[model samples]
Target: MRKANSYLDLVLNPFNLFRTKRILNINPTVIPQRKEPESINLYVYDYDAENIHEERLKNVKDCFTYKHSNRVTWINIDGLRRTDVEVICNHYGIHPLVQEDILSIGQRPKVDEIEGVMFCLLNMLYFNEKESAVEVEQISIVLGEQFVLSFQEDASRDVFNPLRDKIQFRQNKIRQSGTDYLFYTLIDLIVDSYFVVMERLSDKIETLEEDIVRNPNKRTLARINQLRKEMIVLKRNIAPVRDMVNGILRSESNLLEERTGKYFKDIYDHIVQANDLAENYRDMMMNLHDLYLSNVNLKMNEVMKVMAIVTCLLAPATVIGGLFGMNFDVIPYAHHRWGFYIACSLMVLIPLVMLYIFRRRGWF
Candidate 1:
């Protein structure tokens, strides 16, 4: 069997190439740069039934002042500089491993409960239209008794603006609820943004399907491979998040109230739905790949068929020409004037007879 040409295989089967080569020794602790550089900004806000106070802390020391507040405090520290995250973690009593995970932006999505604090890690995903690729940022949230600390890798964009609006406008129960509810709202916001990404992918898939049908070329194959890679990344990021939500639902931690389980469950359901959509898109992409290969093969077969028919029709002329051009002193057509006309007639008539036979046999 021929090997299938697929980007999915190249991504999923990394070791396949190393089967005949020696493995390299490399350090696993090194952090790779995955995003553009941005300045660190800290935004702290506390809200209650009657009032909301927002503060922009200049130094890490000032954020510690709100640690013991009675209201629901949300401290969002954007930009994950190593020293800055270490300082914030020290002040907030975050676990060392959790801090490391936060600093290591490539960490997978997970939930960890240590020393009465709930640490949840998730990916914030968006489609970059200019680059035609998916952009991923890591978001780490720590839920305590009275405060929720969120660390974001990128400071440029956030998916929690609508939730922030709801809190500022006093439009919902977010202010009345505890920090657990606020945590749930943040997660819900991230999961909801997955649908936006899905919509964009769906649009691209539709356009690609049309293009594959109308004209399959190198450009179309490149697009199919690109979409396949994006879907693979989306699936890899989302699957662990779903597991993290499930972990949250199964936990009996006091930081996450029993009442909040339903909201997390809702987020879990949405994640499942998103995974289903990704699976469908993956299957469709595989089918598109096969469709592209089939189109190419069919086109090639058509060209070969036409060439074969032309060769069959010319075989008789080639044979006749070779026979009359022999270097004999007395060839049959070399002496008679009528012999050349007869030989030309025979060549034309022979090819015409072969053409008729081929047509009648449905070879054309």
Candidate 2:
């Protein structure tokens, strides 16, 4: 066997201990979707001016009995299942495209007018305190001659309890109005919810502003980036909703009653306000990001100024030592008995005089 001849060859050999080899797991594991079906909840609220009937239906077919009822019906499906949405939408004459939009996730807010129904889909936003983040759920509403069908992606919570109480405790205006008012009322509740979320976000921004002004650090920068992302998402989701509401107001569908036009107009104004607020918040985030950078740089410049002053004040001492320590036969102050003491005095006195000059001139 041949051996390495010198230290260079030995160090460069393949068998040396200095080299390292790594085997990476580039093939990530795939997580499969569950075959079991998630549960779906169906609720029916049928009401008129004199009386109201509310029930939670166990079977999907039971919901159809209200389809032909003369009273105004509100069928709220709390969870999305493709088969369930297709069946109920088919019964209500809702088109297949509308059904797909109802089941699809992350769809943009839009309005659609079909043969017998006027449909709109939008996002419902919620602030999660524990996660310090914004959460979103998709909601689709179908307005027909006798019924208003609402589909929600989440079943845990919604912002419709007030409407429920109003219905249960004899809110005469909604009870006396037609299905179009119920449709309008449902969309109105969604728009009103934006104000609540905006309030919470505003409070957060105010607090973050104080934090940025008082003391800025890495955590402050992280929070700034996070809030900037949230504002972008908030703005993106809200901007489309204004157009969707405007489309509804201009819709030619016969399902929209002429009397409800005023109510939809009010909602359009509110959406515009919400969009404006989102834009304002996005601008504030940009300003805060710039402020954070400026503060960090200002502090860094302070530290560098101090270091430069110290280096300048010590310059005389360094020069004197270098001159006397040179290995020359005729160097200044090299052979005198008192040369060391005299050089030390010069070193100390020169720095003191230079410091006075710097103070007078404000260089430091």
Candidate 3:
């Protein structure tokens, strides 16, 4: 249902998306320039709306300070606004096509290695209470020998917070390891989030299943539809990440170290688990739909039973009324003093006889 809303909003309110300003500010925390290995230079920075006032262009200069290939470099662009993104793209020697890919806000998770640098686009998502939905941003990471660069369409979330902690914490393998490990850690974090969301979805499905069995109605159908839509969106996002992880496992590129391969395998396992849960939920949804239909049929049958009983009871009454309604002067009941009493007696007895017959037949 959110996907449906997003599509409608994109078509009808495309202009408003820009007019609506983001409250979140981007303050890029760029790593201080370090001595370059004559062959490799590495640089990484994070920028968004908040810090835009003090150091927008200056951070690009910092990114350029490390320019050698022997060292890996990383640059993270947090905000997706055209002006903010274009300025850094210009400084980093990013291709027009790559810039175009970055500009596309709905870009799916993918990795493209260009020349010596590996460019990766990923979705960073978290739930927003105000919006009542998952908020997603495009994250672009550029990996070069000696450095890795990451970009975000917004600054509100620190998608790499764990990775940052790992890097800063002493004796942590991330900082002591190569850029590939840093890359794996970042992907691992995103993949880990899928489980968090899947757990929530599983709880919802369990509740819905109970509701369906107890009282399947319009509201239950609505809930099922909503869950179905959410599952679809999750599947769409998670499927590619699984394939991308598998690609990393299969690729001959040195970007994925053999030591780190096991972790990627672990991420792949999570994806498989998530996939299984999604499939189970889909089956449950179908069963619920069927259950709703069955409930409706049962209600209709009850209604028909009541109507049939009323018609059978009313048949004798109609005949008695029609007989008394005659206008002929020779009618025996019309001349009789007990006419009214006889009519009442017949009407009461007729319904009793029909009721007894119905009870014997088990029609009630």
Candidate 4:
């Protein structure tokens, strides 16, 4: 019931999407930086409206230096280490529970306030073009009064570089705003990536729908089923995130500045759009399933039609042969010279007449 009212407030305004979705077209990609195998990477951007400093820190303890910095700081950890996350959370006054959520991978999307920090744990979705599937990377963010700490499951790639560029090259509102706005920007980018993924999946569904129309075989059926399952995963991830956004909106956490409310609301609207699109796609999958079944039925009907016509054409031959082969039969004209020829001719001619009639009727 609460969820329903929250959704009522969350209108999927496309105009707002155009203004808010800053990175939808650019595509989220890795910047191709090399890292040691299985080692944690810590990158920090300490910035304010006037000045900014970016660095790659060698130690987790280096992040503590920005804990109380006057400027808004964003500490992005590409890979997760339990001890490192714990130490940072302890110094930053984040609750143990929130730290656990950050360290754990594949946590359900949620929002909560603990020890004056706004924490969000959700999946950062990306489209894998090569495999033609959605790939999820768990992202957990802890937004404090002056800093935002983000933990990503995979170190290879992420959707944050575009936001980084906005901070670095461009003098955007994100740089001028506080940690809460930074938090909203991060959430907004993740939501925008959802649209990217949905667009790709939509293309696949379109192509598969056409294939189902022209020629749907066992392999095609399998592909449809696989996409349907992917839809389930999407709904599961998206629905909760919508609720999570609502939780953020309703929170009275001081860490989330009141001015940032509008930005977070924009995220809510985009998420609703993604969730609704997911449902539309699910319905499309069902239609595709029904289409595949219908085409298979049509093919079966064609085979049955041909078999019925062939049986009709052979009936005269079977009856003609049966009459002559009867044991006690005194068949009329059985010994006649022309009798055998007439019977054979009738057998051949009757089928031809039936086939001609069928052709005129357009049965095939």
Q: In order, what is each prediction's RMSD in angstroms? A: 6.6, 10.9, 9.8, 11.8
* Model 2, span 1-364: residue lDDT tens: 3443545644454232221111111121333221323878899999898888999987677898898889999999888777788888888888887887787656779998877788899989898885456777789999999999999878898888888888876656888799888988888898899888888889888999899888888878767776776776688678999999999889877877788899999999999999999999999989998988998898889899989888988899999999988888898768889999999999999989988998999876
Please identify model 4 stretches exceeding 4 Å from their true place.
1-37, 359-362
TM-score of each: 0.84, 0.84, 0.72, 0.86
Find the 10 residues in a row with the least total lDDT in model 4.
Answer: 19-28
Look at candidate 4 and give me any clashing residue pairs.
none
| lDDT by residue for model 3 (140-202), tens | 777656566676655556556776554544466654667787777777888777777777777
Candidate 1 residue lDDT tens string, 331-360: 876789898888889889998998888889
Runs in model 1 lying further than 4 Å from the true structure: 1-28, 31-38, 327-338
Point out the worst 10-residue segment of candidate 2 by lDDT. Answer: 19-28
Best by TM-score: 4
- Please identify which of the two predictions, 1 or 2, would achieve the higher lDDT against the true structure: 1
lDDT of each: 0.84, 0.82, 0.65, 0.83
| Full ranking by lDDT | 1, 4, 2, 3
- Cα-based lDDT at residue 66, candidate 1: 86
Off by over 4 Å in 2: 1-37, 330-342
lDDT of 3: 0.65
Q: Is candidate 3 or candidate 4 better by lDDT?
A: 4
